[model samples]
Target: MSKVKGHKSVIFDLRLSTFDACLLMQEKPKVSVTRTRRDSAAKEFSFTADSIPAGGLKDVRAKAWDAFTKFSMPITTDEAWRRTDLRLLPASDFKIPKEGAFEDLPVVPESLLKPLTGEQHGGQITLLPGGSRVDLDPDLVSKGVIFTDIRTAEREHTELLNKLIGTIVKPEDGKFAALASALAGNGVLLYVPKNVQVETPLHSVLWGPGTDLAHFSHLIVYVEDGASVTYVHEAASPNETGHAMHAGIVEIHVGKDANLRFVELQSWGRHVWNFSHERARVERGGNLDWIFGAVGSRLTKNFSDLDLAGEGSVGRMSGFYFTDGTQHLDHDTQQNHLAPHTTSDLLFKGALKGKSRSVWQGMIYVAPGAQKTDGYQANRNLILDEQARADSIPGLEILADDVRCTHGATVGKFEKEPLFYLKSLGIAQAEAERLVVEGFFDPIMQRIPFEGVRERFQQAIQDKLSVDK
Candidate 1:
């Protein structure tokens, strides 16, 4: 709707100090289109227990570890991390998952484990703090579809795994990414061959461990030309006795004329901290649809990107997040158009209650030769309490004169007229409020195709509202 001043104006809604916000933006927000280059090559790195080792990709693990060792944890001084405060985090206390028996792990809830369909759900992958299990459809496997755990895939399909990992969301791209790349031992890898379409959606769940623990995870999906697939990722945690951390990475590669639908649900405990990076690249004529739901987490800082690299490609991103209590969530999103006739649209909405706070910073960049591009991005926030806070920043940079790009952000609350109308229908005040909030998120919730996943989100929303059973 409205364009802020390049990248500077929208970034003003920061929780960091004024001086820090200015330092991070430095006039226009700096965006990394390709691999990030920092001072890390000179540092020495050693392999940990969880370091994945493959035939040809051995060097990748060592290199990523070296970067992580050399890289310093982000602080308020860094521009990308200026708005996110981690002063209380015990960064030095994190340890790589050790090799041992994982059978004694805690039991996860059944609601989180069950899939919507019996076997129609293509597959289900369960990842823990130290172990993972993948069960795919045997019928699909006979047709050349590869869906398995990342470590196993490394041993089997080393060539394909090496080619895609770090190619899109490179290890050196950011601090969190480097950490996940260097040490994450458990992950999922799904590859759909060319011209093959799998109607059923695959699912993955990351269940948290006990207190004061740290886990690194990864999920990589590669869809070949003319192939189509859908994936559902759910992150849930049990109540913790102390602070916990879950740092993860998600990489998606869509080949020419392919299609992929991705869904991610984040619902951790109040003492859990989540930091992750996700990116998707669509080739010529490819299509990518992403749906993200964040209904839990004590504190979260996520950086997600979309790069439309091929002409005639299409990408859409839709997300919803609700923050209550003392929760704090910050998201920095980027959308880049590098080729002609590519289209991208992003819509993210959030609702804050109690003393919770949330910030969203988004940017859209179009390259010089990217003509006839249609791109739009927006973030809308609903603040339900006077103590709650929500900050939205949206911007665009167009080097191509023929491109149509627009961005806007809005911060508001439930209109009194709507509430009054619902109350006039004999609805209780609490029910009326919950109804209005659900209606607000209905648009984005409808984008999720799976019936089971949608119902799970609905239950989470109801829980946040503290609705009666």
Candidate 2:
């Protein structure tokens, strides 16, 4: 029951009376509704003390609340958040899914229940509405491995959780992360003890029902010294479902001489607004590899941040995205080299069709003391139609003299000659287009470490390319 001022936002509904609604501002303070029309009126609501608490970050929440008291809506017009349709995301309209909704839910998708076929993939584990609790094989656990839910792990393994959480992706860094920390209900916790080598991959899935609800989730992983692990985070909404929101945060830590490979896939309902933030840190002699396949969702925003924190650290990331219909997908990534002899490389490619739009903005920064740093970034896009659009922004910032950095971006179309040649071979246009797209994405897909995920990536692309009557 604090006073949070309203701002000059657009009016999507104008038939109600005097605006007096009270809305949650994610991590910000209480937000009040403003008069948009004589008939438009806002309604007031309250949060009970018994509501699911968000205390893991009480101090940070308080500081954010204090800042919210000082700063109100009609936020400073920052370019980073320009594409985000906050008008559709008014906090008042957002709420946690009712517990009863999950009581009698249908069985999980069969695809999820089937055991993973790839070599060393994590087996089936606990799946929930907003979070997951995965039980790693006891054999692996005996070798100093740790895998479980974030909440339980935080309670039982405080030191491991404390040392990794919020360190890679700080909650205060952005509104999405802040909101996720303030409202997230579930998450995954994974730890690989020092010097252990587990060549298998851990997998977790997040499924949301189409109920116009929101589920903020988090994922934290730590690989101790000389250890190795791979992780996959998959998200999807059931077919034909409508209007849902999924906001999530993921953090991965690779300690000295350790290696980590991470993969992420997102396919949500058409009405869902998907916002996710992923961050990773690499220590001395550590190596980090990342792969992402983005599909589905009406509106989506993602950020991937990598920090090379120790000498000789290395990070490599690659992704492929397919967008169709009126969907809007945006990705922003950063690579920060903070130590000497650190290196990082990134490549992202996307294809847009059916009047959709996609944007890619990536940056690489080499600190003043990060001598002998090597960094490279690239973004490439293929536009299939005149109405579909793509945007790319790749930049580099260097304060070190002994660094080698390079950045490039390109947005183009599939070569007509290749298609024509395929047509002459008696191939239909649809099939020909599929060939071109598959080839365009193959470079990155071939590099994916797991065959099962790579096949999923291919299937996603094929699904997007299939034209509907």
Mark the 10 consecutive residues where model 1 has the least summed lDDT: 36-45
Candidate 2 residue runs with Cα over 4 Å from true position: 1-76, 113-120, 123-126, 130-133, 239-242
lDDT per residue as tens, model 1, 1-469:
6432233212222234333456777677668765332231212223353555444556787788777766666766577775677766755555555553245557667788777533456888888766777898898898799888877888898888888788778788877788788667678888899999988888888887666667778888989999998888888887666777888899998999999988888989888889999999999999999888897888999999999999999999998898889899998898889999999999998888888989888888888788888898888889888888786777677777676677777789768888899899999988888888888888777776767766776776778788221
lDDT of 2 by residue, 16-122 (tens): 11111122223566679665532232221122223344545445445533433332322214456544444554345556765445554544576854434365555
- The TM-score values for the models, in the order shown, are 0.88, 0.84
Per-model C-alpha RMSD: 6.3, 10.5
**Clashing residue pair totals per candidate (backbone < 3 A):** 1, 9
lDDT of each: 0.79, 0.72
Residue 373 C-alpha lDDT in model 1: 83
lDDT of 1: 0.79
